[model samples]
Target: MEKKTDVMSIRVNEKIKEKISKEADSKNMTVNTLVNQIITNHVEEGTVFQDLDFTSVRKQLLKKLFNSMPKEEVTKMAGTMCKEFFKDTTMYLYGKYDLESTVRTLESWFNSSNIPFKEIKSEDSIKMVIRHRLGSNWAMYFETMIKAVLEELEVKTDSYVKTIDSFSFRAYY
Candidate 1:
């Protein structure tokens, strides 16, 4: 352990202190170490910063531009980009990407990228529901990404509905 450089103190309710101590013990950590880590994380990274804020604005602007393009053209372009990103997964997937595993991978990607979606899988089909906050264009963009990934995996969609802020898609294996 590193030597302490500075000391600080604050008062907390007895119940809160007890809860924190119990949590630390449950995790097999010292209360002081757990509290210090929590405080450090709060100070160092409180929330999404300026760049992420600007990213949403940028997406809005780009969506407007892409909306002017032909729908098929824009979707194809987005699909092409997704294909490149997922191309190297051949070895990881053991040469073929099955429908459930492929969509599961997409689900994980959506989660880590902060895209809100609900995916339900069954033996026959997979349903993907996306609640896009940006706009219809972004929703369509994700739909394109999905269609492209399914295409790459050799899965075909049975039905799909694209609206202004949500995408409901069902695909078969």
Candidate 2:
């Protein structure tokens, strides 16, 4: 138990004082402590600095840049990322230009990592093939998986998505 000595009193609406006292009682806190905390918070918020410091602003910009790269870099990064992401799984890609090059790079990396892959022809207008050892419903799986990977790489390729044929898994040898 502590003894109270010097006390300061301030006039307030009777109803407000009663409400404050009730809240303090509910929280098992002294009314003076609760009022002090409220006043401190109010003062601090009222006097909050509005300026954004250069270091903090610069850090935010760098964070945004790392999170998102230029479009060309993202395309190249997507190829690198696909290889890393599907290292243990089978994957296949078919196209003529950039997509073909990207997939070839990934395929080489996969081969070097001992992840087996096989390319099979598809009867579609788009150059397409099935991969090896992808399990079931692999077409849908691969499409979604690849899209997600590209998104992470910050590469947008929805317009060219129709160029991809059926993506699936075959034998795993």
Candidate 3:
């Protein structure tokens, strides 16, 4: 027996409905069937790929390749690239760079990206600590990125970073 489908009534512009109908005709499917398939795919794809998001997989794989090389060399090369990249970003153009604000923004970013971190902040310094998971290298990239941003903003900071058992850093601004 075929699965029963439910009806969903929506109000779309006539032109939009016509476009959908045309697309459905091209695919040899009814408008209803096409819309159903599109909506179903959109809803199910994320659940299917939840823990295996593309960025996570790509970074993990790249880290394996990167680990074979000299880390100090990578640290220097990537830090220079980051500085160049930030020098061209809109953030650098706007030029309202504050250490406290940047720290808060980075904290929010790490939290939203599901990267676990422990941080301590004070009037002149910020410390960030993160686990060096089996296939992720967050230390060098983050340290360089932060340093580059500071340089672009002309904020005087002394940065110390170490990536041993875990990635940890202290930045005095």
The CA lDDT of each predicted structure is: 0.67, 0.45, 0.61
Count: clashes, candidate 3: 0
lDDT by residue for model 2 over 101-170, one digit each (tens)? 4455445433433335555534431232444232323233345556554454444443222212334332
lDDT of candidate 2?
0.45
Using all chains and alpha carbons, the TM-scores for the candidates as numbered come to: 0.53, 0.25, 0.47
Weakest ten-residue segment in model 2 by summed lDDT:
46-55
List where candidate 2 sits over 4 angstroms from the true fold: 1-7, 47-173
User: Which RMSD does model 2 reach against the true structure?
Assistant: 23.0
1-173 in candidate 1: lDDT tens per residue? 99767878999999999999999999899999899877854443223222123123454666678677777876787788656555444224334566755665555445434568887878887788876655666667777777777776678786788788778889986
lDDT of 3: 0.61
Question: Weakest 10 consecutive residues, lDDT, candidate 1?
Answer: 46-55
Superposition error at 128 for model 3 (Å): 2.0
RMSD of candidates 1 onward, in order:
10.2, 23.0, 14.4
Candidate 1's TM-score reads 0.53
* Candidate number with the higher TM-score (1 or 2): 1
Give residue 37's error in model 1 in angstroms: 18
Sorting all predicted structures by lDDT, with the top scorer first, yields 1, 3, 2
Clashes of each: 0, 0, 0
